[model samples]
Target chain A: MTELEIIRLYRSGQQEKAFNLIVENYSERLYWHVRRFVCSHEDTDDLLQEIFVKVWKHLPSFRGDSRLYTWLYRIATNETLNFLHKEKIRASLKFERLSVEMEEKIDDDPYFNGDELQKELLKAIQRLPEKQRIVFTMRYFEDLSYEDLSEILDTSVGALKASYHFAAKKIRTELKKSSIQL
Target chain B: MGKDILDDLKRNPYSVPDGYFDRLKGRLNEIAVSSVDTVPRSLWQRIRPYAALAACFAASFLIGNAILRKTAPGASSSDQFYKELMYSDLIPVTQPYAIFEMEDEEEMETSDEDIINFLIETGVSVELIAYVELLED
Candidate 1:
């Protein structure tokens, strides 16, 4: 179903049908977007489901002010930021707990393949400030226009361009230092 | 610099490992079955500001009512008026008191009794009081 029809179905209380339609429509696209930011398949799985849950809850308030995809993108961006922030706070609050969680993931997480280069790239992305990472991911991976990034980030187009430039430069340098070719 | 970097990054494609989407879909279906009724945090965030604003308005109205009871005219004006009335009789006499001819004895007697009681309570003697009793013709 088209996004508009799915939205209509959801509003009319056909939640299951609407949800299935949304999954069929955007699951691949959202997975790739989320996977770019969080390399671990386990983390991306959690984030992807969380993103859809967010979309379902917020669909009623969608005024069609922007395209449906833009709205979804905005939610995905915010959820990723919040996830990172919470992870950072958790790490600060209890370093041991953070390490334990990492160890548990490393030991038993079925979704994590432990690809060295992809893991390094994600670690470098995480090292970036939130705005730079967002700009970088949206620009490089999602191939979003600067205008769309500006709308999603609530930043001026010029600033987003600058942020993306700096992020790319940093990522390239980091990759070179690690002796990994892009 | 921005254009150059953007173009280069565009040339580099970031790919998810195989089956990521399928796994994500499976996870979503699991969540839907497990907790189908729960709303997301982002939706609640959008409405939170309005809830806060309503709470502020309710608090302001209650506080205004409390202030009104303490300072509005009905609460303080009557007490102020009674105090002013009590002090009005203390003003000094500057001129001769106005007198009119009396016409009845019974009313005069009541008035005289009232004056005697006033004097006894206030420590004024009958000699210090001025009498204006009406004589019956």
Candidate 2:
């Protein structure tokens, strides 16, 4: 279903039907988006559920000021950042580095079928500050345009471009430092 | 990096368990259609972490104060007495009764009623204060 059709269905009081459609249409895409933030399948699964629950809760208040997909991406982005922040705090409380823990999770994940280079690239991505990491992942991996990123992140297009530029540079430097060829 | 190599790497390497999407769809649909909200934390659940953190800070402050009292110059007999009480099996380590035991006699004039009132004013539950009072008894 198109975004308009779903929104119409929701506004027409067929809220459950609209939500189911939203889940059907967006879940797989969102699952991958969230999976990139948290490497573990388990964490991704939990986060996806939470994200959808949030979507459902706030759907009534959705003003359609932006494209539905962009709005959805905004929710996913905020949820991912919040989850990461909470995890970071929890790790710090235990005197552990969240990045180190995430790298270990990536290494030990059975479902990660990436080659050595891909794995190293993912680890380097994890080393980034959280917002930069998300920008890079969305831009580089998901191939989202800067305009879309600007909408989702509420940043200016110019700022988003700079963030992506710096993120890519840092990833390249990190990969080179680890002696991994581009 | 060339666009070709980056595009090649764009192929997602992650995999989910077999039939996971189908299961997830059904689960999410149920959640969406259900009247009960499933995700936001309850007020207590949200507050629990900060509460526990504050409790930890309070405990640490009391323990550190006890240690400082024991090591400070011209330690009093009361400080020694509390130190012995802390080390001995008489009072549980968790019971922070020494918080009320001040080094200066003037500060010692601060009564338990005043302390309990301060704790109540500071948002401590009556149950906890009553438990502490019971410990004092």
Candidate 3:
């Protein structure tokens, strides 16, 4: 089913049908979207499930002002940021660096099949400030348009562009510092 | 940094367990049922914070009143006492009690009756005042 049909089915009280269509259509997309931010497949799976649960609960309140997919994207983004923030706090309470934990998760993940260069790129991405990292993920990995990002991030297109530029620069600088060529 | 690399980055490098999407809808069905089961529990969770705030408000109200009522008997609260209250970490709030300070003592006096009247005017029940009075007596 198309996205609109799913919303229609949901609004008409065919919640189970609507939700199944949603998962079938968008689950993999969202799983990949979440996975870029959190490198571990296990954590990505956990977050993807949480995102769908939130979508189920809050889908009724969706105002249809923007594309339905963009709304879903916004929810995924918010949940990912919140999850990272909580992890930061938890790690800090234990005197741990969140980036160090992330790098370790990347290393320990059996699901990862990328080469060393890809891993280095991921480490560079993780070292970024949270907002910059998110902007970069949405732009670089998801290939979302700046207008779509503005709608989801509630920021202006110019600001999103600047954030992306800074994120790319920082990642490139970090890569060079670590003797990893792009 | 090239367009080709950016395109490559857009391709997802992550994978999930086999049959993950096939099983998700069923898991969500269980979630829907479980969410329904936890409705009453969630309602309590929603109510918990306001309930705690009410408890804190009531405790502070009683404690503040008690402290005011027993300010070293016959030591007539000085201007410094209320000043300390204003500057102290505790009770930075503006209240009827602040008006009853020693600066106004000569004009109005900080007697138990004045405190009772103040507390009553500020919404403390007269019954509570009489109960505290009985305790004092």
**Rank by DockQ (best first):** 2, 3, 1
Stretches of candidate 1 exceeding 4 Å from the true structure: A9-13, A95-120, A180-182, B1-20, B26-137
Tens digit of per-residue lDDT, candidate 3, span A50-157: 898998899789877888899989899899989999999999999999999999888888877776767777888888988898899888887899999999999999
Error of 1 at A40 (Å): 1.9
Model 3 vs. true fold: TM: 0.67
Name the candidate that leads on lDDT: 2
lDDT of 3 by residue, B1-137 (tens): 45433334445555667787677656755655566566466777989999999999999999998887877534546766656655565643566475345344477646877898799899999999899889989
Better of 1 and 3 by TM-score: 3
Cα misplacement distance, residue A162 of candidate 3 (Å): 1.2
Residues A1-182, model 2: lDDT tens digits: 89999999999999999999999999999999999999989988999889898899899999889999999999998998899999999999999999999999999999999887788889989998767888899999888998999999998998888888898888777766664453
Q: What is the lDDT of residue A157 in candidate 1?
A: 94
lDDT by residue (B72-104, candidate 1, tens digit) is 545666866645643455444452131112223
**lDDT of candidate model 2 versus the reference:** 0.86
**Worst ten-residue run, lDDT, model 3 chain A?**
A173-182
lDDT of 1: 0.68
Clashes of each: 0, 0, 0
Give each model a TM-score.
0.54, 0.67, 0.67
| Residue-level error in angstroms, candidate 3, position B90 | 28
- In candidate 2, the residue pairs with backbone N, CA or C atoms under 3 Å apart (3 or more residues apart, or in different chains) clash, namely none
How displaced is residue B42 in candidate 1, in Å? 23
